[model samples]
Target: MKPVSILFVCMGNICRSPLAEGIFTHITETAQQQHRFHVDSAGTGGWHAGNPPDPRSMEIAARHGIDISGQRARQVNTDDFERFDLILCMDEDNLARLSQSCPPDLQHKLHLFSQYAHGTTQSVPDPYYGGADGFLTVYNMLFTGCKSMLEKMGADDVAS
Candidate 1:
């Protein structure tokens, strides 16, 4: 079977989304199920395109043993709607931006990254201007959200 393809999106791609991609990749790799998934990230806008994730994001990910240093920022494209099995945006604004451009037939694949989080907040806040602590908080949220997303996809069997 083809591996499930997931794309994480945010406004700048240098913060939240890249962190989510790294965290999700780490979880799958740790579970020895990396082969079952393909993960990537992008932003709703191209302002940060070609840049690596924000330094703060890389720092927090490093603390968790995940490196996001190699990931570069890109903007969401029409192709992404068809390329990924699931497209998860970090906040409602990003989701709304996607909703506007996504083809109707592919709308089903678009979702809030927090939908599977099982947390009180349904959106992942941007931490670009904040301190290290904000990155840490976003990391924890993505950790929980990624795990829950896998479970919902019935990929929890491999999450062990």
Candidate 2:
């Protein structure tokens, strides 16, 4: 089967999005199901384009044994609509913004990251303003959502 491609998107890509990418990739790899999917991240805004994820985010991820240090910020591209099996936005504004950039045929691929978390369809709160604890909080939520996403992919069984 072809690998499913997932793109995580946020406003800046310095914190939430890259963290999701790293965490999800780790989950897939550790489960020995890396071949099932490809993961990447981008931002809705271009202000931090080409910049690496923030230092604080790196530190927090490092504590969790997942490193997001290698991720660089970039704006979501037109081609991502075609390339990704899922383009998951961190919040509603980014979701709306991505929707405008997405073509009609590809619109169905866009989703809020929290949607896979059982009942919640709310936004993943931006952790840029608070201290490290906020990033950790966001990390746990993303981990939950990503784990759920992997389960939905039937990847849990594919590895066994």
Candidate 3:
């Protein structure tokens, strides 16, 4: 089967989106299903593009035994719609923005990040304005969402 590709999007790639990328990548790799999927992240805005994920984000990932240090901030490219099988937005506003920017052929690929998350419609709050605790909360939320995503990708149901 062809690999499923996913792109996580947020307002800024520094915090939430990178966390989702790292967490989901870690889960897929650990499950030995890394070949089944491709994961990446981007921001709706160009702010922080080309910068490494925020220090708090890296530190939190480290604490959880995942490495996010390699992730750099990037803007959601027009090509991303063609590249990713799913373009998941971190919240409603960004979802709308992605919807507006995406071409007609790719519009079906855009989705809310929380749709993969079990029983939660909450946005992964932008932690850039808050303290370390906020990063931790974002981490936990992404962890849950990533896990759910992995399960749906056949990691949980597929036998090795």
Query: TM-score of each candidate?
Result: 0.94, 0.94, 0.93
Minimum summed lDDT over a 10-residue window in model 1 is located at: 151-160
- Among all windows of 10 consecutive residues in model 3, the one with the lowest summed lDDT is 151-160
Write the residue-wise lDDT of candidate 2 on 1-160 in tens digits: 8999999999999999999999888888888888888899999999999999988888888987888887899999898999999999999899999999799989999998897544577799999999988988998898888888888877764221
lDDT of 3 at 95: 93
The TM-score, computed over Cα atoms with residue i paired to residue i, of candidate 3 is 0.93
Candidate number achieving the greatest TM-score relative to the actual structure? 2
Number of the candidate with higher lDDT, 1 or 2:
1
Candidates ranked, most accurate by TM-score first = 2, 1, 3
lDDT of 1 by residue, 78-140 (tens): 999999999988999999999999999999998888874574447898988888888888988
RMSD per model, one decimal: 1.7, 2.0, 2.3
Q: Candidate 1 — what's its lDDT?
A: 0.89
Candidate lDDT (C-alpha), each: 0.89, 0.88, 0.88
- In candidate 3 the C-alpha lDDT for residue 31 amounts to 82
Model 2 residue runs over 4 Å out of place are 157-160
lDDT by residue for model 3 (61-131), tens: 99989998988899998999999999988998899999998999789998889876665677878889899
Give lDDT for model 3: 0.88
Under the 3 Å rule for N, CA and C atoms, how many clashes does model 1 have? 0
